[model samples]
Target chain A: MKKICLGVVGIVLTFFSAYAQTPQKDSSTYKSRKLTFDEANLVSSYYKQEGNNAAVTGGIGSQKLSDISNTIDVKFIKWDRKDRKHSFDLEVGLDHYTSASSDQVDLKANSSASHADTRIFPSVSWLIENEKNGTTIGAGLSSSTEFDYQSIGANINFSKKTNNRNGEFTAKAQAFIDKVSLIYPTELRSGGGGDDDDDDDYATTARNSYSGSLSYSQIINQRLQIMFIADLISQKGLLSLPFYRVYFNDNSVQKENLPDTRMKIPLGFRANYFIGDKVILRSFYRYYHDDWGLTAHTVEVEAPVKVTPFFSITPFYRYYKQTAVDYFAPYKTHISSNQYYTSNFDLSAFNSNFYGAGIRLTPPKGVFGIQQLNMLELRYGHYTRTNGLNSDIVSMNLKFK
Target chain B: MKLVKLKPKVNRLAVVAVSAVAILSSCTTVKEYQKNKLNDGEMTLSSRKIQKTESSFQSYREGASGANGGKTGGGCGCN
Candidate 1:
């Protein structure tokens, strides 16, 4: 009897110790609060286009242009003591473009300063999110600089998720304060010529834009999701470029002129549907209007086919149509008496078509044996406008984690 | 002029209301574990990073802008 009692006691003790060593089912979860690198993305693109209507040359010259652009974005994340998640994003972009039309800005000179230029933009944003409350707030500052223009922009955003966590509402406000340099055509330049310190010939004007955006996204089911976005934008000051020439019916040439203030509203809808295990359909539609008498409709659709869980091929098509703004007219069609007028073909009524295909690869082990290189995507697109403008673009994206 | 402009707004509102009603009625609560399809990279709601330059150029070339995750002014797209 003593031996049996001792054995039972030993078994009980062993069971209790094992249970103690094992984690409890209801224990509080702890997450690391340290900041850590999340991901980085690099995107690069090359674009080229050709047309006959050049606004800079009174809408009657070559509108040939080429641009090469690259951007890099890095993200980091951390958890605060209050258990709120914080995310930081840093991004920088560079674009180099050459325009034959811009060359015409100096009609008297060959290959002038306006022929080619480079622009640099950098921005940083931070967001704090409370997962328990399903709320987030963010702010960002950005700047873009080029030879003839500079802009500083700021934005703040807030988002809230529904109780069920199936829907979210977001609001954002943005402002851009910009300065545009007035460099008149060579022949148009009056007394003071090119000089480093001459404030006489070169002048600058301010252009300010403010916008408020609202959006709502909802998961309709396991396979379908949708979002509605709207923006109200207002702009004031130097709305037209000083070098864009306009030729009137009277055979006289002058710079483009537009109203100082403008208002715009655009509404958009996006929907994504997983058709099955192999295909996903993405669609977007937008309706846009502005006080300048411009109205436009845009529709885009894309279908991505998953060959494997890690690889996808997507094909996309877009159609856009817009009405000519009240102030827009063809070359030499505008009368000198008009208050506001532009020979820029972009403001003229036209339809455009864009089609493209892309391939994405995300290997389970890594991309090209590099564990941190998580994804790669390559895309090509061709765009054509009804007004005899055509362009092609090729882009690539690399994601590292 | 006011009435003419208001007509489009009214029509748009009606369309949105109907879409909202239809979507809400069809919505099924999806749990985290069942979000595999929605969480796919291709299912992201915003524009992709690769399309950044495309969007920029489109905004510059087109008369209409905004609501497309692209710039809404403040650049010298003089080309």
Candidate 2:
């Protein structure tokens, strides 16, 4: 009986030794759960465009315009005890633009205060992801303010991944409450003499937009993936720019007018395929329709060729075509009989072509030997419309970690 | 002439749809280790970060908006 007890005790000791040899599931080795800085990015762009169609000037003036834009975004991340990941993104943007046609608002001033303007926008977003359930929820708030326009926006998003993690479905809802200051043309203003500094006399109108977007992305194979997106957007309130002048066939000029409510639907598809070890094809197509009798189709394709593991060059082209809205007419083409009329070429039937090339660098040692600078990208694009409009833009991006 | 011009687009769409279905139906359950290509930075199906401003300008300049992962409307592009 004594020998039997000793053997049992030995077995117990053996089991304890095995348990002690096994490594403990220590939480200390896990990633820190406290919020920490993840990365930051800066994007800058210069855009210039010139055309003969300027809506503000009865659609027959110089449409020369230039814009400089800059944006910065920072991201923070944390994890919770339940293994949920939380992320926060903060962004700020600035845009300064000059338009030659705006000077024609007064017709006598070579340069008017409205010729140049600056816009500032800021936004913040938060996302919480539960890895175990493959689901994420997010919310965001944003605002944009400029000389004549101000907007406040909010959005909420939710996404879920398939059981096998090969597919994801996302739904998002957004709303923007905006105010547009009515700055009618000098001749069209209530007062005979218009002063740019006098703002108390200007009236403000509300413009609101709401949209719901749904998308699904699936991995078709190891080297291919595809996504489908659809959006329903509705807008109410002032849809016309007060400064836009529409010339009637009878030589009468009036402020542009349009329906107070608009509804839009856009459907899109995107596909990306790894053609070879070093080349990838990305393609997108979209069909859009609106209540104002506008129908459009857009197609874009880009091919990125990897020069090295950390370097790539992409060339892209986009084709777009649209039918004119029912209320749209060219210069001095609309009749006084039409209740709603606009001379804005933007709403006219037209097609456009845009082509661009971009280069990206993600060096293993970081950009400029700075360990924190992760990547750099530069892109240039040229756009042309069938209606004698053309534009060029150059953009740069810097990513830091 | 318009119908002739549209014929190519319709055919292209049909071809794309067919190929997409075939590719999806023939998909094999890819293991995590085999996802390197799909996970490549350049393989993202969405617009690149460098294209942010491009998308914004396009939305302003073009009559049609949305479906490009860009804002449809809010800010005044009015110069």
Candidate 3:
């Protein structure tokens, strides 16, 4: 409610400011004098890739794994009479990573590393829309090579954008089905002394989730837009940590066993500011709490400043902190024989900070003798975790009409 | 009744059909829409950054054992 009021006040102030400032266009007023919705682009980039240090762990027995992935994607969009819409997006990609293991708690020491498999994944997307009535429906199917798993999802969205294209309401319901395929068994598992599934080849399970998304987007005049989104999600089936280990008496090791069902709801706010003709301000904040008795807060900020008309540099920063789940323990801290206990740092008490910058360059009109070169983006990221894991990533993307 | 079980699904289908129509309608003016756009040099979606920002969750990528879902592709030993 406060945000809505602020938006209204901002729009009113902007109107007054513009009305009072009787300005004449000098050097900058060269071409267009109006905003046309027809100039809007539906499909932008066809193929893109990005690499960012997705996670980090730094403490005892710590290991670091960073990713470098590249992808090729394409899209086909068509519009029938009466503004009906259909779009198909197909993407294929590969990923490679390096990892290290340690006997001690210090991730930096004895953290020797090894690289593994180049994976291929393909996905197909379908989208149907009716902009006039403010409704959208989308579904997708995708899979990975190594996991031999597939994801099937569908969503329905309802939105109302005001006549001025401001102050919009949107709600979405989505669901997904995921099949688990990743297997776990360290090299030493041949001894049959392994705590978890020494004789089991794989533990397969099906996971399903449903979510509701609600949002209000407002254009606070021409220079600013802000939106708030709330997401409620619930998932069930095999939520275990396949690779994480739990140490018990005499360093007895066990795989993580988690509850079959979990629930989470997150509320977030996003704001975008037209700081200048060539600079933009984007900021977001989210508060999340789950049924597992865990709470978390995340905040992020990004600024993109245009340079030379065809290139822009974006710098971003994020901070995240979460409290431990009820069944989390660092090592042997688990005393109860409960059905759910995990030593995974993902469930343990920890905080992390991610800071990075990226540069995007697009050819100006008529560059490279290509009439429809939409974009080219390059990005990199680095993340640091309290658990002694740090990683880096680099990626690139190309867009074409 | 079976009708009860089908209510949400049917409702979703209707919404999807409507939304699809909305999107298709958008394409009718693509040529016209291409004339007055900003970010014409290249396209940018501020929300897309959210996908990248989501990586900080740790659980999103680490837990999936490499589910590799969504727009971004990654290679990590989180599995």
Q: What's the C-alpha lDDT at position B25 in model 2?
A: 83
Q: Residue B73 lDDT in model 2?
A: 66
Cα lDDT, model 1, residue A161: 97
Task: Give the CAPRI class of candidate 3.
Answer: incorrect
User: Clash totals for all models, in order?
Assistant: 0, 0, 34
Off by over 4 Å in 3: A1-62, A101-115, A148-150, A182-203, A366-372, B1-46, B49-78
Please give the C-alpha DockQ score of model 3: 0.04
Which 10-residue window of candidate 2 chain A scores lowest in summed lDDT?
A: A17-26
* lDDT values, one for every candidate: 0.87, 0.85, 0.53
Candidate 2 residue A297 C-alpha distance from true site, Å? 1.0
Ranking by lDDT: 1, 2, 3
Name the lDDT value of residue A399 in candidate 1: 80
Task: Write the candidate numbers in order of decreasing DockQ.
Answer: 1, 2, 3
Distance from true location, Cα of A205 in model 1, Å: 0.4
DockQ of each: 0.74, 0.62, 0.04
Q: What would the TM-score be for candidate 3 when compared with the true structure?
A: 0.68
* TM-score, one value per model: 0.91, 0.90, 0.68
Top candidate, metric lDDT: 1
| Per-model chain A TM | 0.91, 0.92, 0.74
Which residue pairs show backbone clashes in model 1? none
